[model samples]
Target: MILHVANPIYDSVFKYIMSDERISKTILSALLKKEVVKVEMRPHEYVNTTRDTLSMFRIDFAATVREKDAEGEGFKDRVILIELQKTWLDTETLRFRQYLGAQYSNKINIRKDSPKGFAYPMVAVYLLGHRVGDIEEPVVYVNHDVFDYNGEVVEEGKEDPFVESLTHNSIIVQIPRLKGRVNNRLEKVLSVFDQSRKDAEDKQVLNIDENKYEDDADMMYMLHRLTAAAADSEMRQDMNVEDEYYKAIEDRDTAIMNRDKELKHKDEQLQQKSEQLQQKSEQLQQKSEQLQQKSEQLQQKSEQLQQKSEQLQQKSEQLQQKSEQLQQKSEQLQQKSEQLQQKSEQLNNIVKSLYSKGMNILQIAEITGINKDEVAAILN
Candidate 1:
């Protein structure tokens, strides 16, 4: 027969184990280095409140502890808040601080002799499936410190650190770092988280030596709880729900990253297109300037042609005036020629008359002042 304990890396299983008053005291007592005599579970173990846009639903086990002395007698009862964390996530870091702050908000009356208000001592036992903060140890203890500019302890030295400072206290149990190695009772108890199922057949029992833990009843009890939890169908369903919840968160984050990447790519393409358009616009501007220069040159040539045409029109007007003056001179000469021809015709007629009156041709030519041959011809 195989002995198994449900992996405490699962919050549900961790919660189950921590909820047991006896088991939780054993674990907390080992972690706090105090002998827990009696433990009473406090009310409102889990707060489902929301803060800062985050669901403040945290699995908490508030334990009131009565420590045992060497005489096996109980001492003054102490309040310690044991928080079971399966995994530490980045978003939940702030939430974790908020949770611790919430714990500090409450005042517990511990002693009738002492003051009426005090906060509970908190011990955060993290059954981490992964490592954090480059811490190589399987178990790392963190204590709140009051330091100055230098790394010097300024708090009053007290015999008990947890009692002196309730604010600065935490214990981290990194189960993956353990790697199935057990050195102490605490490690033995935490070993259940380190165990894996025997096969992919989903068997509840772990194939480990039960004899090694037969002397340890707490380990045995834990093994029984893990086996029972594994066998439980309803519990498995609840675990499945938790798995899906975490998966959905991862899926949502991945989707956002992919969407941002796609948008960045689109922005790059748009920028390239804008640059291309700007280049084209610059080219068009250059072409337009060239066309304007050509038009200016053509306009200058047209103005030169217009000036030449005006000069030619003035020369044509001057030639027309000269041609009119020549016509007037020619008309005066024609009138003079007509008057001479009339005088000559009159003389010729007189010559003929003289000849007819028995006068000689020479006397007729002298009277007309005409040539004698011309008068003879006229007489004949």
Candidate 2:
């Protein structure tokens, strides 16, 4: 089955170099402390080639080495390739075989051009992000060699009775199955790769204890940086959401404040109108009271005028009776005419007094024994 692999973790790269080149050199150098020469580092590169119309690929990381072997012999000390795998698939074995073949081919071709026969051993290291079980050891592989009954190796196609024939050699390191079997820097690097793979599969950032893997300092640092980057991305998202939330709240508050202000303004206008209406009502009530008092006073004056009219009517009737008596006695009639003139002057004074008291023409006529039409004509 085809499997898609993800990109290598920074920790994986760091761990690979630490385990193979860095740690191996340190241990081997310490053992041969007297004859070790300078160590050199090379840059990493990725190579892709088409083999039988199918694409094949491999990555080579920086290789470091000491100048001499542990026996103080001057030798082209070390050559290594760093391989990273985000996932393991069926094609992994073939892929590694291709890498091994290419490295062997290149070395053999270079040796053929040289004056002396030289054999340089090559190491191919793979850092895997998945657990590979079913292997008895952390690093296991097949070695092709012709062995005699005494377990001695012979040269390829060279038949020697005492020597076994050597044909092919390969190594395989299963990272996940290496737990609890980590003995060297290489094993520790594999352990870190296993942990990082687990974290990636779980969809979590690596959170390893730096103190525990102090020997793999570069690996720990790389993992820490990646985890921090993820956290920072999350924090930025949260901050943006918080900012938007506050903005919405602010807008809502402003709307509420504006509505309250409008209500207050309307209330103020209503209060002013209410006060004006109350004042108008009070004025109207005062006017009504005054009109009522005026009506009462006018009614009392009308009653007094009615009483005076009855007295004046009785006096007019008496004067008519007196005139009738005078007509029967003509000599007494002239003296009665002077008496009637004095009575008419008193009646005119009473009528003037009633007119000064605000009586209407009809009321004055009724009170002063005068004809209503005659009183109206005099007033006009």
Candidate 3:
């Protein structure tokens, strides 16, 4: 038959459920697979009653375990410190460290063998209300094993005081992932924290099949405890308060996320603008360099033109001087021509007189040094 019980996801309900010594021992034994000889609640166990924000619901225990001897001859008793925490958010790394540091620093986390107490091995169990990264497993066990330089395991399951006290082991139970998975006794014990079993109509209550867990006495005891919690008026009221608190926290986180997204968008836009401005500055610098080159070329062309102009001026001056010399030569030639004309005229007159007096054409040609035909033609 399906039975109604208080949802153990609530801090108040979870505290109530784990408060039982039998349940705690049963759970520890199932998870660690060790025979728990004794269970003692540590002083640090508490439920944060503040409704301001969602916080870790943590509990600590010191368990005496009965285990086989190293020689496999007999049994031995060992005391180990266990820290169990339940959290709804994934952002608990710093908080987990701080809590763990406190446990390590605690003076009572020691076993009494010598005059001074020796440190006990530490075990951390986290009941995460949310999923961890991409791991889909319901239970994750993290243990430390010593290895030699040859890449071989030193001691497979043997516990050493020096190593155990200094280092620790951890078990993380993702409660959200415990859906339809009851293959082991540990998973079955952890089914109490499964959110899927919660009643569809009500968030505070869960419907479980009693017949399935009827064979297990410890499991039946746990269901009875949760059933009592469901009837308790005060526990029910506390569950409601927790619901409101978680709602407020979710709303606040959403707002912060939205604000961060807006800031990221603005930052991206500013980055793009900065890149564009840089490109424009480079283009302007290139244009300035090109203009400088063009100015230099123009200066060179102007210098060449000036040299050509000066050469042309020199040639013009030389031409002018040659023209003056040619004009003078022409004037000298004209004067000489005039002198020759006068002499010719005088010779012609003399020739006429000599011809008229006694000389003939031969004498006239000899005197003038002209041909006889030319002298006759000149006279005619």
Candidate 3: list runs displaced more than 4 Å.
45-53, 156-158, 268-380
Poorest 10 consecutive residues of model 1 by lDDT?
Answer: 48-57
lDDT of 2 by residue, 168-275 (tens): 334465655654555765565444444433344433233344565556554455444444444565543543443454465556557657866875686566556556
User: Please, what are the lDDT tens digits per residue for candidate 1 over residues 142-251?
Assistant: 87766668888765553253454355567877755777778876777666666443434543234556788888787677677777777777777766766666666667
Which should have the higher TM-score, number 2 or number 3? 3
The alpha-carbon lDDT assigned to residue 370 of candidate 1 equals 77
Give the runs in model 2 whose Cα sits over 4 Å from its true position. Answer: 1-57, 61-87, 107-113, 116-119, 128-133, 141-149, 153-169, 179-184, 196-204, 215-380
Candidate structures ordered by lDDT, highest first: 3, 1, 2
Worst 10 residues of 2 by lDDT: 48-57
Clashing pairs in 1: 6-226, 144-168
TM-score of 2: 0.37
lDDT, model 2, position 105 = 55
Model 1: CA > 4 A from native? 45-59, 62-79, 88-90, 108-113, 146-166, 181-185, 195-212, 281-380
